[model samples]
Target: MHSQDKLIMIYGANGYTGRLIVDHALEKGLKPIVAGRNKEQVKQIAEEKGLPARVFDLDSVEQVANNLNDIAVVIHCAGPFSATAKPMMEACIKSKTHYTDITGEIVVFELGQSYDAQAKEAGVVICPGVGFDVIPTDCLASQLKDKLPDATHLKLGFDSGSSMSPGTAKTSVEGLAQGGKIRENGKIIQVPLAFKTKTIDFGNGEKNAMTIPWGDVSTAYYSTGIPNIEVYIPISPKGAKKIKRLNAFKWLLGTKLVQNFLKKQAGKSRGPNEQQREKLKTYVWGEVRNDKGAWVTGHFETANGYELTYLGAVAVAEHLLANEIEGGAFTPSKLVDNKLVERLPGTGEIHFKPE
Candidate 1:
């Protein structure tokens, strides 16, 4: 139990993933304060759960910190975090509150790391990418990190047969303009989409995978000290061709008119329904190697990514509130033990293997 009677505040509580986390909290009988920038939407969800609600923008760091008064840990579910994370974190640091968010954007990881010393000094934890974006991959990196302790390079990948949430889709649209990125020798390097391709057997079978600028590009470097990192995702041949074309026209995608049109089209749909989400499965794979050519591979199969976020984020929150974890700007892997995903509540839904 949390000793201080401090609340777990769910910022952006009305978001697709945010609402799920709220439900999970309620189901566990852990009372969390619901909050967001939308008054009506946040109030409705808060009313439904009988939880306290706060409505405010990131415009005022003072107010954000004031609102976090009784909160011990915050679950920030809003995105594209590239825009939202900075302000929220700035406020959290000032408020001296532990912060965690379901962010996959590499920019957010970089932002968090930049505040590492401040977070430690403030006696607060700043952990982002607690979602599917990297938790599972972060854990797999640890597995491979242990397997090849002197590894200098890391390759991590995941495939989940799940629908994209509106927030996830929005983030993708934002990234379309940026192309792709990878971390090399402790630096982030931009590349065109599909810069590299490989075949990965994510337990079920081998499939075509494309290098992507997943969160691990930042998190893995910090978590395992692997200086070179690349993350991949399985895509169809058609998907590959589509991405190549998008890369060619990325500049146009960056234009306000095109981005607005895409956003409007994207806003039409929400995330998956419960039936759809529960049926989805996720897979993660990682390989780490040294200059000696020695390498190790690891795999993990888990429940739906969104569901895991609810579980993973809440568990991390409990750990934070209990001071079972340390204060720092941390990736999920670094803040928690080696097998956090396996130790989580829904562990029955996960399978892990090493080779």
Candidate 2:
């Protein structure tokens, strides 16, 4: 793809993750068009970064579709995607533009899958969960499938870096509010958030982990035909107890008052700033068990989750720009190559062992 033809649009250009993605895209020599509902913010970012900007309300599907001309792909960073992904996807399908997002919400991911036939017909790809939340897990599962060809159960655990961003916190809060699901007997089964806990030893030390709803919970089921899949994140014992306690009040999550309250809390929540991110370190370990009782595991770590997410997004964007992947709606676990995953930064540390 010529540099001029690589017109990438960042939908939530003013936000935290969006800004990182935009900066990475620019560094890669791709001139990105910063776009968002907030014209002033978008314009400011574009002007400061020396890029172009566009304003569009996500509520208007027609307007989004109309604006897709000449764009190679749209890297959507706006979230709470359960409310926004569908419309944006419809617009992309109408415009025959490739669509990718960092969303890990199972509901939104499943909704993206529902567009497979339409996207295939349009010769466009709609990929969701192309970031840290699922990419590492997805890629590890794919690798394990190669080592344990008959694997039937998959478990993933990760030690996150200290520097959590507002976007990450918001996603976590939303997932907590909605609860989580895992594959069982070849079907999606809803479960209470943080219902199960495990101790994962990644060689550094054993960290307490909780069952979290990760995109791979859905993606791995279809990609590897694994009947059971679970993703876990290491948390402090105190944090684990707090999450368990929060489960008791899950009912409140459905109430508007609670939701609004969370929104307010999320607005005030601050994550580590730029300097802290530079010092952060993240690690992930994964295990896949076969029906015959054989299992294999792998480990990976990085400077930070957000940085890894930016690298993953850039990898996905490069693939989209080159039209290297088959055109259809899919997840990273299904679409991205395991070898390529290893080559990506922070992924080289991944080590696999069979038992």
Candidate 3:
């Protein structure tokens, strides 16, 4: 199925990352329907881009399914996906439309996995974290697993040189409210923010990194069957201390009042400009260790976060549309492979070694 043969809709097409995905899809010669809950905003964006529009919220599964009529796939970009993934996923399964999203939330990834049976039953593929959230890390983890098939523990880290979009900032706020997480012995468990810190060489010299509730904490487990996993991001010592301090106020941060206020502030900030997106880069590092203390390490480089999201999300949707992949939930690397990510625009060669 080519672009003209199948209709794809981009929900949340008015948001910053959503807009980037729309542009990428258009550049690939696809006429995707732009959609979101705000009728006026969605319509305005669609009109400006000269694309069709559909306005619907995830409040009701029936309503959402109705809006998805005749759409072959949906690139669900609206996030803080902890709140949106379940409903949108249910609607997608109900409507028998393939579902993909740019979510990096562990809860959302698990939520998608929970619907694997339903998605398979309905013959609809459900894939999330098709963006900067987990693509690079997921691919890294998969590669490490390939290098060390008996790996028992997996660690992934990333350093991105781009600014966050409003949606990503809001998602960061949501993540902060939830504290930190990691997968151990095949189960997810909560911990304090910045619970662990270390130095990692993500293609560059060593940098300080701290553990966060990155999507790979959940996705890498599924992608590589690694029973233990931890994901980290670059952070300064001061930043780590600040996050550690917030652990005492986790209750306040999780409160609706505080969350709403913080999200509002995050929403007001504009993301990276075109020049910034072009100039910045992202690096991913992964290591897998076995009971015998054997290990393998890998590193990858790619475009900036939002730029990778646009390229990765559109590419995943196009692949789903053109192929008859199995009907089930998947991580980005699990759905395709590391090669798919390696082939994206601005992706660099991957390096791996055993030690």
Candidate 4:
């Protein structure tokens, strides 16, 4: 399943992160067919990259499916995945094409899992969270699970001092009303933002961490079968307090007008440039504790989170195309060995130690 042999369609190929994926895919000499809802942007980008392009919307899912006729894989990159994941995945199933996306949305992962049987029946691989949100953490969960096979509880945290892209910011803004979430006893549990805070030691020292609705609440569970899961991202103490306070205005945040206003305020698609990504470093920590009260704590070091996301998404896609992946929904860690992520291109200085 080398690039030449597989024609991969990149939906939302003109957006910030999508363009990164497309540029990197081209650099790797992959045969990509770029598609998106925005015809002007999509065509301009396709022309610049000298790739074939198509424009379609999820509203006409059958039309979307038709355009995917010969494409073996589709990387759905347009998101606020809350609105995009289900429709794009349904189109993939309709087209019998393998589905992948650079999404870290909790609802997206859960939706992907709900479509597992259908995906398998359609002979398609439905995988989401092929990005910073869960790739490293999912692998960490797998690593910890291996060290503590009897592990029943999993806690994961990551700190990467990097800028967020406009697309990412919009996605977060889209979920302002829903608040934070976690997995307890395999059930999705909702909680207020920053409901839990702690000091997490991710290799160097302790940093202020707070609970977030990270995709691992779903992905890691599927990957490692950990019934209890909590994921945290670094936050300032003040920021943590602010998150909790924001919940009082959940109704205001949930309003469409507010979400749209924030989207408009976000301006346009943007991301950290190469030099910025090069300077950024990422750290991840995970702990798996069993009922016996024993636990294995581990840490992972990698390049920037977003950089790793670009590299990991493509690497996972290539691995899936070149090899045999089970037909159904899965996380990166579940589909490939934990070592696969550690071995990704540009992935440097990874150490997983049980303490």
Candidate with maximal TM-score: 3
Cα RMSD for predicted model 3: 1.6
Best by lDDT: 3
For each candidate, the alpha-carbon lDDT, in order, equals 0.85, 0.80, 0.89, 0.84
lDDT at 255 for candidate 1?
99
Q: Which regions of candidate 3 fall more than 4 Å away from where they truly are?
A: 1-5
Predicted structure 3: lDDT: 0.89
Model 3, 19-83: lDDT tens digits are 99999899999999999988998999999999999888889989998888678899998887888
Give candidate 2 misplaced runs (Cα > 4 Å).
1-4
| Candidate 4: C-alpha lDDT | 0.84
List CA RMSD, all candidates.
2.0, 2.0, 1.6, 1.9
User: Candidate 3 vs candidate 4: which has greater TM-score?
Assistant: 3
Superior candidate under TM-score, 1 versus 3: 3
Q: Which ten residues in a row have the lowest lDDT in candidate 2?
A: 339-348
Question: Per-residue CA lDDT of candidate 4, range 187-284, in tens?
Answer: 98999989799898988688889988888888998989889999988889999998899999998998989989988876574678999998887888
lDDT of 3 at 92: 86
Q: How would you order the candidates by lDDT, starting with the best?
A: 3, 1, 4, 2
- Model 1 segments more than 4 A misplaced: 1-4, 324-326, 345-355
lDDT of 2 at 122: 84
Please, what are the lDDT tens digits per residue for candidate 1 over residues 1-355?
1246677899999999999999988887799999999999999998988888899988888889898866789999988899999889988888878889999999999999999898888888999988777788898788778878999999999888887788888888888899999988889999998888899987669999999888899989988999999998899878887888878798899999999888777777677788887787777788888999888887767778888899888888877876755567988888986688777544343333433
List, residue by residue over 196-312, the lDDT tens digit for candidate 2.
889998646888888888887888776777899888888778898888887788888867787777776787766667687767777778898877788898887655677767778
